[model samples]
Target: MGTTTSGCCFPLRGSQAPTGPEVQLCENCKRLVLTEKEVIHMARTGMWEIEGYEMTDSSPDFPKLKESAENGCDFCLFLRNTLLSPEVDFDADEIPRIRKTYRDAGHQLLFHRAGYRMSIYDEGKLWLSFEIWIVHDATGDMELLPSLSLQDPPKPRVAPSQNALQSTTNLFLRQAIERCDAYHDKCKVGRDPAFLPTRLVDVRDENAVRLVEGFTIVGGDDASSSSAPKYAALSYCWGPRAHADQQLKTTDENIGQHLFEIPMKGMPAVLKDAIRATRELGIPFIWIDCLCIIQGNLQDWEKEAGSMHKVYGSAYITLCPTMSKSCLNGFLFRDPPSIVFPYHSLNGQPAGMYRIRFTRSWIWKMYLTVPHHPFAVDLISGSWVRRGWTFQEAALSSRMVLFGASATHFHCRTSRVTEGEDTETSVSLDDLGLFPLLPSTLSGDKLDEAWKHIVASYSQRNFTKHTDAIAALAGLAHRFHSLREKDEYCSGMWLSQLHEQLLWRRAMYEGISWGWFFNLLDPELPERVLLHAPSWSWIQRINIDYQYIRDSVLPTEPEDDGSDGHGDMSITPSPGLTDETLRLEWRLPGKSGDESSVVDRFMQFRGQELEITGFVARFPLANADKPLEVDELREADTNLFWKWTISGQYFCHTNWDFLSYTSWDRIDKGEFQHLRMLLLSSGRGKSSGEVSPGNAASSDGNISENGDVEEDDRTAFGLFLFPTIKESENGKFYRVGTWHSFCNGKGGFVRFLQYATVESLVLV
Candidate 1:
């Protein structure tokens, strides 16, 4: 915000690079004091406050302003950002001159990449024509010299390679610590519920980085331990079980022995990359699950797992290998990947002017502060995005540097930028930029919606061990609790809408799918979902409908909100009852029930069951996306039977409800098939005059005045029940698709206010 006291020209006309001491002399007092990097960066970002200096706006010409500024002032950077090809054709040797001028002054120019780097781009319309770096001296100040191109510039001698990329990565890591992180200002410094000591790999000095003998957490609260060292954490996919002899894991036997002796040769590529990054970023310590926590000891694993919240939240930064599908894939590429587009000015100068376009998504177009660029979004939606364990890792950490497919992205609670993007574009997270992540500070997020956002994204992810479903979300759940009311966490559902959550069926339930279903209908898939949670918990299912889980009770749309980029996943539930909960006991499908108990599997409700006498209808499996109306279903008066093919001798015929079997027939007597059914209230919520069936439709007004229901609550939610795998296990019932569903207006069902007097039920 400072101005020139002597009214000197920018891009100084003389033969020397402009020095801060000469150009920024006090206008009123005639002092030679200058600003530092921190001050310039702030001014460049429009902060406007430079200590001891007057803050004033400057109205400088684009060409002249670019000529000065040894380290490239914020104003010059902005002009470059929105600069297009000019009409005048001149200055064939401008880049060489600018470089020489700054080289003499001991300052070098740098690009957005790690170190002081430069890129020379060329296309017919806009040459982006040239980029330059000037250095006052090797150890002196360095920055990007003002680049000028009115016509096509000569090609540079250097090409992008490993060294350049390394420079870029190094610069990004440095800026993250020095500029992004607020450090102690906003981080949760309070001790968590448990004092579980942590083992951290001290990587500040890579050569002296002792492992088995790493640092350990100590002392009580910060009040007593004010000088505790800061650290970083890593979130990544462990991949499939590697060869035991090759992988380095902490076992109960080696708990105190060979940990430090673990060689870097045996370390997985993922861990090696993370360690190197930590060291380069200057973090004192790091924590990884398998090495830091004893892998073979149940007691140690349980304690460490419980304290995941504090471990991540307290870290100075978190490194995310967002593009790596597995540890074997590794991270840190040799060159930054990017797609370039060429553009000609629309100012009627097709051949007269051209520009290079590096964006596919505009931040302002999204009508949001956090916008998604198509390139970034595409890179983000990779196999790594589906890992069940990493969901909470990204959410809990205050700051993160996501190393993606081609380039890396940086994000914090207050700001975001990328290695491939201009860092000076925005000063606040609320402004426009090239970030592909959500704001860390979710100012207006709702509790139910937040959980829905988490579930929707988490359900779509892949898990090595299905048992880790809830475990993976432990940190997210811990943080979510702080934002919402003290609602009990049901195995997976919340106690607030326990009834509606119970009605959750897989997106591909009962051979019905809205989009493409990835897995087969058979339950015996390669990735066996070990039954650790109750059958009611989604933790027990696979290929779950990620979208449905976000708003299980609402008619929702496709949204990528939450940490995984899923969006608008909040459910606004209707006020209803929650004084009762269905209690149950369960066992694995193969271990429960006996041959004589096969009938018990067909019917397994334990409490008083009351029927609501509702209408029955069959789902049009082909048109599952569209709810089948009562009129359309009743028109198909044929009796549908669900047959048990695995047993080859049994089938049951029911009117609509998968329950209440009417006829017992062998597979040969009926069409062997998978069927979806629904038992809906026949306008019965109006029996007490709360809402008349005819009046309800008329008031909503989707139907004609003559009383024809055109749009039934097909997309609405309702109570759904399906028999467990035991229905096929005992050899007398049907077990087709591992997933199930029900269709009834029970639309937007907040809770099961009209449940049959049925309570206790076992999945087996």
Candidate 2:
């Protein structure tokens, strides 16, 4: 074109322009046609430029990217989206696609945002630049780019050389050292800035001979230098031995591991099974006081006492060994909330069964050791409730954080003997007690008060007197029972089982006395006789008879063979003319035959009767002379009456003898009847023959020559007889009768009977 020297420059029409730079299209099109790699290089090198794009000092047209700057521009918008957004939130449909397209085309979208300017500069070529501003609608959503511009790049600033930067850094370090010295003089020895430095020097001097260390110091003029003081030291300053003494104390292997072993017997089978299950599950430790702590050492005990919570908390699992089926209904069997949800399949399918929620901690409070003193600080008296576990769940789920004892025997023993002593310790956590805390709950003091009331209501003696006490006890029992039924934390079955166990324990420890029936018998009787007696009558009649003979008739002095002074004849009855008549004779030591004679004199003594039904005996009077009266026994038409007789002056018949004889009759037996004959007397009473009824014998001729009558045997009859008649002395006897004949069914009747002596009654 130049060679042609034509004055006109012809524009190329459909045909492409020449590839040479000098022959390229106008500046605008040339800027747009540049390769993406060239454009990126221009932007990064700050070399892209355009003619007539220079700014004057007054214009200051460079864009500000900071949003806080007053003259913020589109460049700021690009900066904010590309570098400042804390989280990325690009336009979903286009951003990822555009990024991928650019990446595939070997071109990068350096930065792009709505209403923002993007630019590129070429460094290899004459400083050339291109810029664009994105346009957006009123809604603030982004739109396509609408305009572009080209600009010339500015010159670079002058800076110091590398060597100059290093010298300035050294000078900064020297100034920092001078400032550090001045600061050290103003502060105390330990608080001085020099303190750490001195310590570091000491360490370096000790270890520098053996160690090579490199370090960098920052100071003036270096790009990275700061005005702050610099620090330097040998590597040994930070070595392991520098603060070896400041390390934590080494733990002794036995510090918390010293355990006391206590052997236990008579553990419930259920508990044993639970223990076995726990062991099988891989639980390694248990802190049961009866099994883990020594019984006698106070120091050891205190140590255990202090660490009770830690022991329980750190346990992999606790075993609740309640054997009572009722315990299944209590709080110990509750289920945790985590297990309540249904299982979900990996494909988001719903599973049929609920998944079990397993937790690392299972607190068995009712069975765990009570926290004492400071140990209680972290323990709540009722931990389960506090942990958001309900009593019902506890009652249902056997595997729980806490467990309760089924039987009162174990409960009381564990609570009172082992844990009771620890109650004095302060508690701060909820897991310490038998139950956990729940919302709208009473404080510990209030709960204690409530517990007292609950306990009193259930007490046996209290209920026996006050009918309200029974109701109160029942109410409490039912309340707890209902909680067991309703709570998800434990199973109702376990709670119910616990109740049954407690009842049984109460019966064994505080209910009826089987010992009284057996222990008050004669030793001479066959063991079988005493052991086999199912009711109190057998004990009173057979065993008590011999017991009375030994206690009242036999002399205290030991004979030649170590037998009682009284001869054996005292125990054996002689044959009489009739089968119903029996006679016994014996001599008291130091007493004459006349004084011990049976036919000499007669004595009448007043006594009272007590009744025995089944294995239970009731004393109706405060003393023997008082009349026997039981409101429940007033309606019987006839009652069994056991009579007594004491004869000899020195041989006194105690009232207990009246209980030994087996006799009974209609209450209408003509005022008095000959109950028995007496043989001997010791001091205050007389011997008698034919100890007959005060009135004449009945016309039916029921009386025998020996003075006993074979009366109608329809009424209940049992005997406790004493033959030595004594006058003006009180005697003990037993009578089974009712005050009113018509109301016979008012009181229950005896269903069984057996007999044994007092000496045979002791518990082995």
Candidate 3:
């Protein structure tokens, strides 16, 4: 057998095959690519259903056919793949059964048209599907086929070698960078240059020792020193605790030595791969968080970590090791295309120099290519997506080359290109659900929509330390802040949308226990709250789902447009909604000019809490607000809300394990009369009608004392709270859970609030 020059496949050495139109082809294989333009034309016209060719059980030319199929014939490759699944590996022993089923069964290779793709079937069962296209293989050029919905041709088939893969990837990187820099306006580096990070790994000289050099590019009349140096940022997982020892980091002890030399031999495989990729792209520097940030040094870590937005957003390109879970694994190497089909011109001429691979399937084109938000579909899955810190890193970057499990994908503001494929101009980075390049001119509604999507997705991710949750998201928050600098960031929630942001509920997932809700805790203890995050903020909980309640009626500071008024987003007030009982104020702790530690400085302004002048309704709460002592309450009050009326009210407790009857009995006996529900905001009922008497009725239609009926047309949302007992916690209260009542004319929360006294209180 003689193999191709690329050594990818073996062909019959000197077989005198028929030439031109007289070439030997079986009935089934001949129809597969009968007329190159004919297949392409049929695909364009949506007419794939045809009487397919059948495979005979036995043939006089069986020996010749087997030999032809075994060799590098395109028709034979299709036959082999039809007998089995492509992109899947099978053992030699399993091949007998696979071929036996097809040989005797007289399987037929059929073509069926799907949405913008073609599906192949054998014996009336789906064999495999492919996204086929016609292109000039010699020049890597493609003809525009709008009817077929073709974006680009698949990546050219190459020899299964690491060096080949690397070389091809480097070519792709160069082309992507060149095109993005020249034509993509959204992807270009702005005229006002962003300075490099405080520290960067110098990867300029291949022979020289790599070092972590401090960089500060102050732009001026001089172009070289003024312009930010081209650099790459690496995004990867650090692996589990077992691999902690293998992680190379810059620390206080090694800072001096790292400044002189960062030993390439001692570095992890992922880091080394990133450095190699950066050098291949002709970038002079690269940023790896563990190597650039001084680990274990709180001040240095915080300062660098806080500015992650600038580090990634300003980088020339981010190298994403999406397939690798740990620092020990490298992403540069890849398995070449296993299956290759001979290329033919649209005019039916042999294009022997190049080959094609069925890169995408009908299923992939259906689900992944939909014009919807990326988060709605599972586009990319790996350790990178699961990490909390990487969310901001990917979201902030303008361009990234993701080394995915199946193929290498390049993403920028304007395009998404996969290895061996043409640049897909219709799709953008946001379409992949990796990162959304939100325009700086975004309106309030667009900003809110993007923010909710981000928070919903990011909240589901994992973090090593729960305290790092707010910090991990700070970079993204900082970017949003820059768009609207007048808005104050309150830990996690924005002051401009504080009321609506606080309405997030705990999103539950099957099989995963999303932390239990706690009833009460000692306010004097600092651990009662999750570090600086207040109870009202979603940052205090993971996996929260926000449903914006209604428009704000409370007083808000006018946006300081600062002369240019560049960030003005038109605000439309709700017609009838208002916060009648609550006047909210954010109280920031006094900050001294002298701050000793980095963490102290970071948390100084983040520790602020809400001081509300609102109505604190004294009521005996239900099981949802707090885990009531149910066993004791069941006997004391048969008319308890849980027993008599099952109202369609929603409550999300902050923290608690189990509900007990004791708390209700205690309230009945006046032992726990300190519980209060602070009314925050209210709105007119979604539908206006007199409260129906049926709303107060129990399952048996019997009215109970606790189910008080009232004629009302309003709904209210608030917090369930208990006053602090410790002297150090005096005049303060802790939020046990969230509360909301849909105003039915009977037993309405708005009517209940009418009797409550409004007072000033601080919530911890």
Candidate 4:
């Protein structure tokens, strides 16, 4: 997604082909970019065409580009190259693998000089993959280099001796496990060594892998004061399966037979590789969720699932089968093209292929394995990162061993080392920015920021089970207990951060009907999701776009609800606030509370009489040209309301329809239920003429903790009025939109403002 700048956004791609070392540039355009500000300017103002309004060949710049194409410009030729152009910078051995990839997709892969980019072309669909690396040439001119991506798949390097227990990868695993042990005993860090998990699959030995008979929990500290088994956990995607796809499950009957029925060879590829790796690492046990948790038994699944945080966090190490799409897709693969490259000095002199240290990280030490940098490319780019379960697994574990298609990786607290790479390229762990799940030593206010970070990341990821929204983060949420007292977990929103947390929304996109997903209007996606949660909770509106919302500030802890578990769901105005900004004493319905009563398909603000206060006028929704029809918003000037609302898991609308933009952060607090959410616009006062918000033809809809909305001398704050529920009897309201006007509405709005009394209303 392209980023918004100032009040607008530019096109993500350029009108003409991009220029630089990595980017193809014709002789005429080579020195052209270094002198002009086109690139930087385009980045700010965006391309002449936005999403809804596209620029065509008639666009002034398009003629020049087309002429250049006809004139055979080098950059133009590169862009127009529809036929296969023989290209290569790789060693001879990689050709077969590259050809195989092309054959699999019926496409061709092309690599330009210095291996800057990989262009895949088949039919009319073309994708150019390149990571731009900038450099300073001898003339002091900046140059760019595109890094190519045909690295060989990682294969375990086994030791020469048949008696050797450790393969090259297993050696690093042993060191990571032992290093954690050393930290427990010697380091000043006050982490507990007794934090071992409650359950483990005790791989009998290097010769055998199976769970102990009738062994669910390894009876240790809870059963005795003695030590427990050190185990490794496997993290991989289950992937899309057949309609009736059924993996092995543990049930009451099968639980007793697992030891007898489950065998190493019978396991899936990923699990088998995990067992082999665990045995080779000299760890006596390993834990896999699917194999250990009884699938059909809800009670057993919940009990084991809820403890996943501790199981993963306390594990000796987490093995990431990064290359696999499913358990069926194993970690090990046939070695492809080599990662090592022939070295070239500053003077362009030929040097030997660059060497990489496999033994240092492979040999492990007492200090932490810090990440030197984020990986330029992550493993597989598959369903792994997309899975909601994987985030917690990756965050909770202090150590991980990633078996990727390109290379292996070792991650711990201090460092992240890639297989077959030198230290200079290693990523530092701090750059990963894992919140609340950060090191235990990192406590205090930063934890809140970390928690939000985790929430935002978790919100964007997907879950196979829409009901597992909270369950997926149950591990991290359980750990956040000390951050606040009990009753903090309200479905998905926190009681402490209730006010701001309610601001979450579904991600907005382009082309889809925005009206289909809202709580009111022609609610398209509303009927699709499960109703395990109240309408107000983010869990009910799963697959949110929380990351785009600005949450990068400390949270102001509101007064705790202080109610016991299963409290009442109601609302009241927060007291003692002098400013127009108001806080609400809104209580989310408890788990047992009747959501149908608290929230219906349509609900209303019940009070004596209502008058306009103020409505939010956000900045432009990502350079959208959608006309804003509402006006008279409080202090309206450059503020632009979101022009569209779309549906996914929640009511959503994006600026450029993809790249995220800031959304309004006001406390509607169930105020807009029943799809009565309004955007009141009146241009009664403003220097920039009468500026309205979104057009009445449509409807769409946060301050950071440290952020504040300052009152300016622009105009009287306008009241953006929206209808809550369209008064449906069944209590269901299809979300359509709101009404907007540059001038205050003559009839209802003016009469209400003049004759209406300030009446407090409770939405539910």
Candidate 5:
């Protein structure tokens, strides 16, 4: 049934388009005739606009049309015309009103000859395009259209059906189930048992499916009931199955095998010690890699790599076999037989009802071949041993642990002979004579058949040395060092030097210490001495003391020269003692009677204690034959000499002795009789063979047993005489006392005795 805008339904006449705001509606109820075009237009525009018609308030159609337009025309018309006009009839006259009302309500009527009717809006006009006509009984009265405005057609509501929702849910469930089943299938063939699924169930009911946890099948026949399981089961059978299957095959092939052969020796005692310690600790597992893995299979090695971290991390304690004598002995079977095995049986016979024979097989089975606890043997050999391929300790010690043997020590043999009857059986031994010899085994030989597969499986992981599995082993070594008592001693500064030497030897030169690593050099000598020369008389006190001490050891005859004689001589003495009859002089080379000569004379007195009671007498510049004149005598200044005298006194306390006094006269021009006589009396004259008093005693006061003094023990003294002549005077006479002394008391004592005199005669 078609709805009309004016609450009426009417048959259109002719092909005329509606004008002047005419709208058709059902006569008995509110409805509107909307053409496809009108509906399309309204939908497209999102708004409805109709031209030209207004209903009068007095008109019967006014209320319905107003109501239809005001309150959702589609719903209002559906209710008023279709629901309220069930038995109502409409006349031809009423049809026009109904159409006009619909038109006024902004709907156009469409008519078809086949009784199809609809409303249409074309261009700027409302036109009758088509109508849906229901066939009527011919006998029934012809009904007129109702004066009701058609409301807008109700909007369509689109919602999904239950089947669709169910279908969607089924799709997701199927995918999840497929994934789960495929997983289980892979796990069944995979080597790792933990990957297998423990529980599986199908949940097809929608509500039950939603409640399903993880991957599940829903609304499917039981797996056993079906000729073929769909989805996951199918996937397991075909899709990408070969990859998982091949992986499984590889895992099975490589599992429990080892690829590297490790040869070691000198390990029996260490192994035994480790075993005993393990037993004592009551540990259940030990992870000695050599025994744990098959040496001929890289697959096993790779698998071990995954669990190595845990294997090492969980270990209770790791024992280093080479750390001590006891450990080494245990590893090498060096211990006494009594300690290793307390009881023995002989020939399977009962001794006093007890057998006393040893069964080698039982021994091997009980101790040698027995596996150690997995977590108790994490200790690994150091880099030095590993790099050198010296696995003796590592191999045997590893056998005591559950970790079979370290890959580095697998297949290793010791020098120790296997127990059996010997036809003089001989076993090759390593350098230490502690390990059994091993034949060469290489990984390259097995690469194609085994190693490649293992490598492919673990290629995704990085195994850089510094950060990989060995890092843990290094840390373990450090911990072991910390626990050992030797750590402190080994870590001490001196010991570190040894460690450095070892490190350099092993790391730098592959275990050799040689001179080629260091640089060296050669050897050479030294230089000479310099001296300052001056007249001996002018020598300072220190010079005098040095000369005195040095010259006393060497006696030599004085040189004869006029410059050292009394003629043209000068006398200078103490300033306060005016004794003109006395003259002071010095006898030495290179001298003349002048101011310079007098100064030179005083210089000779350096370091000597002199008692002067004489006058200053200046002699002629060059008059060897002239009479010497004594001026009004006054004591010459003696401060210079006094300083030397005091020093000499101090020296006497230090064991110096004087042994000689000498005089020279210008008139005699040689050794004068008076000076010679005085010199002899004062002990100034010593023959070349004579020994000085200072030499008679040693510093320690021990007298020499021999009467003659040793050269090294000699000391000496000297007195000098000079004759003065004055050119201005006719005749004069002067006497000067010169003395010599020695040290002979506790230290050395000095005693002075005069030894010189000279007479001047006038020659004018």
Candidate 6:
């Protein structure tokens, strides 16, 4: 190869293609940009590797190019943004040496016809490897490059054609639907909505939401007589300004006018984009919450809210503006600009010939990994996946086109596809969030896996109105209800697994302080939310975790109605318990009177408390490891971060300080034994030879302190109750927290049961 006067032995190509201003390239940096002929010739082969050159201390002043990077050199900028930068933990000082490149403290660059791979290594371990591949420029391949410095933000790298609709985006949508219809047998089953939303926006019109029955397709027949016309649904955040009267919303006064035509120019940007996308996809109607449901009309809102499951689930497809922070932010915003290397010719002459857009290291890092959850990568900077309402919308929909930042992501029950050259990375319905895609025939352990996964994920999300916590999940709960039609939804928990669901604990994370009694660290606890639901329910608080207890936890005892045993059933009676000793009765409001609607029935259920029959045992908080005197405990108040004790197996978790709940001077002996354990169910314990908890004390003289007893496999799960003036027919107690006892084969389980007094209590 001939070399340029600047020692730039590189090939360059010239074309009329628009690109950023040319950047000065060093002699060694010219190889980063390849000629069109070289790219094509190399593309014919499988792979290409180049080695031998190494820049070291003996090399020229490579650091001198930092000034060029700061001034705006693309080659230097790419180096500064990637390998040569110290942004990430592993920092590369220079390019890999010829011999040391394959070993420690160096770097390696792998090339292919399309693009290249850059790997950074330290101490003989691969620290980071990211790929930059060639992507065909399309009408929708519009993305904005990052600002070179704090002061200079670059313009859009690839602008869309003026009159061209996003053909690539439309193609992905059409292909996704076609593939689902043709190949996805699973996706074809039971996903069609039994009925459409009460109303839908006629996308072909600028603005209008009509009754689904009377809606007319744009270029097709009237939908009333035929199977409901397919419609798209818009899933975007309403943002804090959503409730402002300025937002375009369908109301009682304007309902008639809205049915005729909606003012599209005045609508949120997201709504406009959704309508545009739907119209381009040949869908005549789309359902938008603010436009379809009457705002400010309580009855209409509740009625429509109850049917949201069908609205999204039945839609032909859901248009998710994944990166949109709010309705105001349109989905068509430019993607993060990728690094582009202007192609060079064999003569070392450079021009805007081939503006090859290659991905940045950060973008590759974000999308390359299998996300821990649905939209994990999107959630890193976007608000769509973090909102509570959108959670179910994404899960319940039959198909979705997530208009992501860099590329469009398509999802159906059978497959997840991302637009671009990288096809290996895809989402799966088997992953968390797509709950409706799960097997409907799932039972027992499978049910636990599904429900627990949902709860854990949903708990971490933010809800605009705390009241919508359970309401938002009603649709998903209904789907779960279909698996076992006999089971009832109790606020958040199911009546079938009420006992196990009651065992939810406040999920601990790094930000929160969690330590033993002596190391009491107070977390910034939120003001206790007051809801009609019982404290035992997970709905009482967010950021909760649940333990999947088996049906074997049901005690094997006779029924109060004189039944012999729980026979030929999934839930068997444990060896030592009876119906009276361990029973649970759900008191729902609709059971007493006829409820006209599902919304009303669910509202009544959410407001009702749980009635449980179990054995009550008391444990003195005074026996805790860092026991506090009356004055010290009372002064600690709600801020007291100390934990209480149950048995020697482990330190028990309490929702609050039990010591502060009692009247210090009013107690008979000032013992502060206000901590009460109510055993709801029991099962065989996990076999172990571990020592008892430090605070463990024998409640009975007959119980042995030594590990001499037979293998007593009894594990009792229950709630720790605190006395409350709030009374009910059975008993008056509020749930402080939950507990499950472990058998240490040292008579600890027997002692726990011996201390129990059988009683019926209503938890509030």
Query: Best-fitting candidate, measured by lDDT?
Result: 3
Off by over 4 Å in 6: 1-165, 192-194, 205-226, 242-246, 337-375, 421-430, 433-445, 509-530, 547-581, 589-593, 627-672, 683-711, 726-730, 744-751
Worst 10 residues of 6 by lDDT: 147-156
**Poorest 10 consecutive residues by lDDT, candidate 4:** 357-366
Model 5 misplaced regions, further than 4 Å: 1-273, 323-329, 332-764
Off by over 4 Å in 4: 1-166, 183-199, 213-225, 243-246, 334-376, 379-382, 413-415, 419-437, 505-507, 510-515, 518-535, 540-764
Candidate 6 TM-score, C-alpha based: 0.63
Cα lDDT for residue 22, candidate 6: 49
Q: 1-764 in candidate 6: lDDT tens per residue?
A: 43323235322223432342344565445544444454344435522232221222111223434665666456656644433322211111111222232223323233222223222111221111123231222211111112111001011124222222377767756877887788776664546533566777776654453434333433244545546667888888875543234568888998888877777667777787778888888988888888888899998988877777677777888888866666666777554433554443445444333233222223211212332222333443355666788877866777788876545677776666655323322233235532233432334445655676577667766776777887788777766666677788777777777666676665432222111211221112233433445556666366554422332133334433232222221222223321224678877644655564667544444436677776777875555454222121121122222333434333332433223323334434332376578776556543332222222222212134553434554656667775554233335566766665544433234546777787777765
Give candidate 2 misplaced runs (Cα > 4 Å).
Answer: 1-299, 302-449, 453-513, 516-764
For model 3, the superposed segments whose C-alpha errors exceed 4 Å read 1-165, 188-194, 216-225, 335-380, 420-445, 509-532, 548-581, 594-607, 619-675, 682-715, 725-731, 743-756
- Shift of residue 271 alpha carbon in model 4, Å: 0.5
| Model 4 per-residue lDDT tens digits across residues 32-93 | 22111322333344222211111112211234445766764444343223111211111111
Question: Candidate 3, residues 656-695: lDDT per residue as tens digits?
Answer: 1112333434334342366677776666543322223222
Least accurate 10 contiguous residues by lDDT in model 2: 739-748
For candidate 4, what is the lDDT?
0.40
Which 10 residues in a row give candidate 1 its minimum summed lDDT? 85-94
Give the winner by TM-score: 3 or 5: 3
lDDT of each: 0.40, 0.22, 0.52, 0.40, 0.23, 0.51
Q: How do all the candidates rank in terms of TM-score, highest first?
A: 6, 3, 4, 1, 2, 5
- Tens digits of per-residue lDDT, candidate 1, 123-161, equal 221112122222233333323322222222222212223
**Backbone atom clashes (below 3 Å) for every candidate:** 41, 136, 17, 55, 132, 16
Distance (Å) between predicted and true CA of 132, model 6? 21
Q: What's the TM-score of every candidate structure?
A: 0.51, 0.16, 0.61, 0.54, 0.14, 0.63
Residue 318, model 5: Cα distance from true site in angstroms = 0.9
Name the candidate, 2 or 6, with the larger lDDT value: 6
Candidates ranked, most accurate by lDDT first: 3, 6, 1, 4, 5, 2
